[model samples]
Target: MNVMPLGEKLLIKRIEAEGKTAGGIVLPDSAKEKPREGKIIAVGSGKLLKSGERAKFQVKKGERVLFSSYGGTEVKIDGEEYLLMSEDDILAVIE
Candidate 1:
């Protein structure tokens, strides 16, 4: 947790994808699709505007958020997986 995302960026850990089918069939790893939902680990300070001011980020750390499946860049931190994406990439925050 030593790394912090730069401006307007977020560090998130993807939630585990479902491992079972609705019909009670267990799905293997290869059959599971990558999850688009995740918990925000850390967030950047803010977006720098042309006016030389910083706009606060709407999403906060510990929030569960939804993003495009192909949006973020995957990174490994000390063998743990995380996604780094811009704030605009987030679709919604799960309440």
Candidate 2:
């Protein structure tokens, strides 16, 4: 991919969940929940502090993370969908 992530941002691809309810019911298109889980594909270098120092990002590439459903901008690269968001938008890293 030619696109590069910058400035403490992340490039993430959302994980596809089972599109069904627990009662063996297949949910409609609109009934699907917003997936909060995803795998991080790329991470920014670091954040620049006010004192001219860079604060490194904690999340790394290939790490699984949980993010807010309302966060991020959807982008398509090379026919693949991805979410571009700041590191702060990530809720937590999934173990």
Candidate 3:
């Protein structure tokens, strides 16, 4: 990727929203919610530690992760939407 995150930041590409529900009902454009999940596109080196060292990040590139619904900055790169968030903003990694 052209853009690299800085200091514990992560660059994620949001996953597509579901087109239909489990009940076989198609969701309209307005009914669809923004997805809270995404794949890690890029990551920063690490966060600074008090010991004059850099702490390594727990998450790596290409992992599917769940983030806060309202967290992160939405950005567009080459017409594609992505999220720029801190490592702490990521709630969990999908197994």
Candidate 4:
């Protein structure tokens, strides 16, 4: 399913947390940490500028990014967790 975002919102598919611990111990779902990273699936048109010019965001589809731990609205799509947020909520594009 192709999902498109509207007007300055970003659609990010959250990466799943690893289920194993550092010591090779298997961790349960309750032990997983919220993933701070995700792959950019879809991006909205750039934010409109005061002069009416749209200021485009640097992020693009397929780019891996890091966002604020507390930012973005949680959403579920096709039974998978995702995040929808403004470009400002993105912290950095992971190289």
Candidate 5:
């Protein structure tokens, strides 16, 4: 399914966490923590400013980013998990 975010919002897919420990011990699904890193799937147009000019975004689509751990609303699209969040929720680009 195709998705388009509106007004500085972004659609992200979380990167999966490794299931094994450094010692090679396997962890159960319940023991896995939700990953805070994600890839940007879609991006919205820049936010509108008071002067009718749009504010520029520091990040773009397809960039990996780190976000606030508790930020963003969880969503499911085409049976896949995704997050819908504002650009402000993003802390840094992963490079």
Candidate 6:
């Protein structure tokens, strides 16, 4: 399914966290933490400014990014998990 975010929103796919610890202990699903890293799946047009000019986005589709842990609404598309959030919720674009 195709998705388009409106007005500075972004669609992201979370990067899976490792299932094992450095000690070789395998972690169960219950012990896993939701990953804060994700890849941009889709991006909205720039935010609208008071002057009617659109603000440019610092990130783009296909870019890997870091976001606040509690940010974004969870969504499922075609059985896959995704995140929808505002650009302000993004902490940084991973280089």
The 10 consecutive residues of candidate 2 with the worst lDDT sum are 27-36
- Which residue runs of candidate 2 sit more than 4 Å off their true CA positions? none
Q: Lowest summed lDDT over 10 consecutive residues: which window, candidate 5?
A: 53-62
Model 2 quality (TM-score): 0.91
Q: Which run of 10 residues does model 6 get worst, by summed lDDT?
A: 52-61
- The superposed Cα distance between candidate 4 and the true structure at residue 32, in angstroms, equals 0.8
| Clash list (residue pairs), candidate 4 | none
Candidates 4 and 6 compared: the better one by TM-score is 6
User: Mind giving the per-residue lDDT tens digits that candidate 1 earns over 1-95?
Assistant: 59889989999999999899899899999999999999999998899999999899999999999999799899999999999999999999999
Global lDDT scores for all candidate models: 0.95, 0.89, 0.93, 0.90, 0.95, 0.96
Tens-digit lDDT string for candidate 6 (1-95): 89999998999999999999999999999999999999999999889999998899999999999999999999999999999999999999898
TM-score of structure candidate 6: 0.96
- The TM-score values for the models, in the order shown, are 0.97, 0.91, 0.94, 0.91, 0.96, 0.96
Best by lDDT: 6
Per-model C-alpha RMSD: 0.7, 1.2, 1.0, 1.2, 0.8, 0.7
The residue pairs in collision within model 5 are: none
Q: What's the lDDT for candidate 6?
A: 0.96
For model 3, residues 20-68, the per-residue Cα lDDT tens digits are: 9999999998999999999999999899999978889889999999999
By TM-score, rank the candidates, best first: 1, 6, 5, 3, 4, 2
Give the range where candidate 3 is weakest over 10 consecutive residues by summed lDDT: 1-10
Q: Which residue pairs collide in model 6, if any?
A: none
